[model samples]
Target: MNGHQIGEKVAVKVGTDMDEYSKPVELEGILKSKGDLLGYLNATNDKVGEVCTLSIGNLDVIIANRGDSFITINHFTRAGVEIEDYDVIVVKQGYLFDELSAISKLDILAMTPGSTYQRIENIDYKNIPRPIFPMELA
Candidate 1:
């Protein structure tokens, strides 16, 4: 069934072992905006209670709302390992509005990388927390 049709309560498999599974949990969230690439979910007032299970592929990611601005994800079976971040996380749901237009813009930029893009060096990168993986690495 499609994600939207799954409704309030649904059974989701958790853990590598098929035997270990979480009970059918109630899913709650507002479908704030439906973007082609990602569906923005505002879980600020979601009645998730304590924790909710999210199935990405075969992995079951446990998510819990810590407050209005933050949500925490506890890596499966890793007690101490928790990932907490802003609630506005991108949850990829689908594709973009105009694929061709998007590609053309990127292609044009790529053709004139040096001429089109300018760099400002010697800035304090430590001030802000880099969101993406590569940005964090840099």
Candidate 2:
């Protein structure tokens, strides 16, 4: 709906690893293009450096603004272009600052693949339990 509100057609910019969402997703503004979100954003903001994004994947990846997320333009500021309206704000972090925490009623932690991914599974355990998943799946 965000794109529709702004009159910009949206669609996944077909890429290799982007098939995770192979099925259709409900959105607005209509599927109109096939390109990378970063590339498009970069092209659109070619004259400026204020727009930045954080992508954890490599290779040709589909791009869409709706149902997508954006991080801070710089590393030390808020996570989005305008984050003053969201009720259940979702920011990628293990913790929150004092100011953001003050207005929040509850906080939920959704663990994602990062430096602390898979916990004990990713660690080198020479003496722990045996027959673990993935590593020991045979």
Candidate 3:
């Protein structure tokens, strides 16, 4: 209900692998907020076949069934959602670019500003470690 529509390109985080005869899990309950326990929404899996895009790092895959949101990396068998649908797909992963390079047109490292990815020079060290490489080079 976040205004997301079908056929829109999006990248989603990798989910657990599904088996061939996996059953569709359904849920129906009130999503409550923390502390106050106030009800957020009366959530249910009524619209099972609604289309939505799953976003990874730079890649977006169009998924028709809501169940397909938890899709496998196997691209050969999946219908509708194909690699050709995206120009530059970003799969939010690390150290696996080499394996995916065979099917990719180009690869790029898209880093964003965050505490986890702050530059070394910008960091305020509590205690300076002895004999650091780049930190003590200049």
lDDT of all predictions, in order shown?
A: 0.30, 0.38, 0.37
Candidate 2: pairs in clash: 13-63
What would the per-residue lDDT of candidate 2 be over residues 1-138, giving only the tens digit for each residue? 233322244433322343342445533233322222232122242222222222222211223333323332321122222344334456544555555566569966666644333455545457767677766775
TM-scores of the candidates are 0.17, 0.35, 0.32
- Candidates sorted by TM-score, best first: 2, 3, 1
List RMSD in Å for every model shown. Answer: 18.9, 11.0, 15.8
Model 3: how far residue 18 lies from native, Å: 30
Error of 3 at 65 (Å): 19
User: How should the candidates be ordered by lDDT, best one leading?
Assistant: 2, 3, 1
Q: Residue 28 of model 2: what lDDT?
A: 27
lDDT of 1 by residue, 1-138 (tens): 135332233443323232223233543442211111111233233333233444444343444333121112322112122233222233111222343233232322222112112222422345666563554465
Could you give me the TM-score of model 1 versus the true structure? 0.17
* Candidate 1, run of 10 with poorest lDDT: 31-40
TM-score of 3: 0.32
| TM-score: model 2 vs. ground truth | 0.35
Q: Write the per-residue lDDT of candidate 3 for residues 2-34, one digit (tens) a residue.
A: 343443443333323353224343322221111
